[model samples]
Target: MVARRNWAGNVHYAARRFHEPTSVDELRRLVAGSDRLRAAGTGHSFNRFGDTTGDLVSLAGLPPDVTLDRDRSTVTVPAALRYGDLATALHAQGHALANLASLPHISVAGAVATGTHGSGVRNGNLASAVAALELVTADGDLLTLDRDADGDMFAGAVVSLGALGVVTRVTLDVAPAFTLCQYVRLGLAREALDEALDSAYSVSIFTDWRTPLLREVWVKQHAELPPPPAGWLGTTAAETPRHPVAGLSPEHCTPQLGPPGPWHERLPHFRLGFIPSSGDELQSEYHVPRAAGADALAALDEVAHLIAPVLQVCELRAVAADRLWLSPNHGRDSLAIHFTWVGDAAAVTPVVAAVEERLAPFSPRPHWGKVFGLAPAAVAAAWPRYADFLALMVRLDPSGTFRTDLLDRYFPRP
Candidate 1:
């Protein structure tokens, strides 16, 4: 919509019609006219979730309407609103989201549909925050999806992968905004991964995969009293083992706050405007069982030696269990190991293979946006709900207008 090209450079087949629709009727008209149609949000998804060669319908111009009911403690928002915008608005009303993914720039609707998450022991995927939704089905029918209305559709739409329909609005159960004491410290020797994780509201580790050591650990505590009003934030109650060595590569940095109370900025340590990343950087993340996190990290270490030197970064984090069928957590608490590299995937593809080979014992769920992947059959091993998810997709979008090569790869024709 904005100059045609998106942030990720997802190109269309041709210079097609770009429509910005505010109402469902306008979107329906746009979709009806085009042979192949797809709705796009802020275009934050890294892959082709919004990649349609036909008409591209953007909901950017849609007015943002958020109303909060303190008595019920829920806030309803326009699906097109970015989480960053949503968070700020929510904070103004003394409300906050339960959790937020690393980057706040993504649209809540887009992120929820893809199962976006943040590191936390008590939090679930963003979609799990939904209490209700205003959905526009392909046949131009409007429906409000809720847990009681249609259970399967409700579960599937959470990670619907933008398949079921265009989510126009979302109402979420919110919590009273609380301050977090962000503690960050090097964990050169902290091996208390699971136990330490259990103590904090959220945690993050920035480490080089090549080493057996946890380079650093970041813990966020529930602060009844504001954190030390000076100096850098400290790591949580997790014990950090002593570093026997002087220094590895001397590359360690801490997470910083953009501003307090606004949870969206806190989701990501670095903002696109504050600090720019490599123009050619690529990201791939996988979710493993929380119980298997330690073992998976050990297996990853075996290949870490191969990737350490060439790799940009390896991030370790956790996400709470959720009921959303396609959420990475699915029925189990999840630990995500993420990778960001500087160039073509080929340089890191072999390392990813080594990880997959070693991680066979603990089937890993790959993130939808990033590229490291397995076929549909492989995904079935990671998420048991594949069959149910596929079945719902067929019923909701039998014609496959929302289908793409990526969807087909993860979801073979039934």
Candidate 2:
């Protein structure tokens, strides 16, 4: 119980008073009694950001109550609903989320709070799909937020990272459901990221320092026909991003049609799914200005000497720019660079140092879910309105009822 794996494979001190509350009433009581508490969902995060010293809250068992608003084209789901089930439920109602992550196993609340995103040039992160949310704040006070009202909370809640409150339910903007004609291709050199960048709506390449040559690229085109009738869906790994370590880098993985089906298939690389080529690997993802992609790639490569061997894979993804304060792609169209490692995290962390060291001019936004040893000042430096957000948090949770050591890490100094 002390040691558990998050989706990104980071471990830390877990909660002593872990609970799955069935109702707000039970949660209020639990929250009121705890000295230190944190809510966890699927343990899919990369760092101990969810780790707590005294108590942990697991929302997996909560009853899922889903509601659809046909007029507004929105779906409201309990915070605990797995993204997989949420999508399926939404589909049955003749609706689908605006876009979904590659792997749909994550929780809607957790993903949005952390600004989880899938590759897309025009689309936005999952948090953008949120139209409204019900949050239980520090004093166990329930509050509602949306674009039309409580705008400040709405801005903070979109990517709150659990700092503002415990999200209870989320109302997401939905679109007419559709299917994708998927193809995974290899060969987008770290250098060619610019040349081939605009070819697909969503593209992700997996590789590490060992091969500067991009290893795997997932390509998809919207299709009217519902997913190619079984066998025609391309079973063998012969297509793109050929599975089973192709180059000097040996990845322990087998390529199949795609696991976890439609939902989990969205994000095929992360855990609660396939582990990709490297076993027990560590990962780091930094989102930088899209213009700096080439430069960022060059910087990551500079650390190849220290990172080449332990590096299992690196992924490149593009995201449309947005105005969200804490968004990694804030104010600029962005490229997310990922580093997957084959060995020790303590050893591989230096790679992050090198990437950060070289990318100082770019001022990259670190993925909230990955392991990177940058101080809060550095983290907040990437987010301009972080100070305002802190002020807002103080106003809303002045008692610090929702506070944790992790929260202190970000707000304590200020």
> What is candidate 2's TM-score against the reference?
0.86
| lDDT scores of the candidates, listed in order | 0.69, 0.68
Question: Residue by residue across 1-414, what tens digits does model 1's lDDT show?
Answer: 433655545333332677788777787666555566677776555566567666667787777677898997888888878776777788887888888776677787888888877788778878888888887776766779886677866877778878777788888889987766555555445466776567567777777765566766655666554542332232333233212112422112223431233354445443423323323556678899998888888777777777676567777788888878888888998898887765565676777677777777888888776656565567887777788888988887777767766677778669
- List model 2 lDDT by residue over 1-414, tens digit each: 222446555575555565778887777677666656677876667776677776677666666778888898888888878776787777676667766665567788888877888877777888878889887777777888887776755776678777777788899998887655555555445566664557554566666567656666665445443432333222223343344234642232222333323422343343334333323667678889888888777776677787677676666778887666677776788888877666487677776787778877788888787767777788888887788778877876676656776668866734
Residue 166 Cα positional deviation in candidate 2, in Å, after optimal superposition: 1.0
- Tell me how candidate 2 scores on lDDT: 0.68
Extract clashing residue pairs from model 1. Answer: 183-234, 183-235, 184-234, 184-235, 189-241, 210-304
Q: What is the C-alpha RMSD of each candidate to the true structure, in Å?
A: 4.8, 4.8
The regions of model 1 sitting more than 4 angstroms off are: 3-15, 225-267, 271-279
lDDT of 2 at 300: 66
Compute each candidate's TM-score over C-alphas: 0.87, 0.86
Off by over 4 Å in 2: 1-9, 224-279
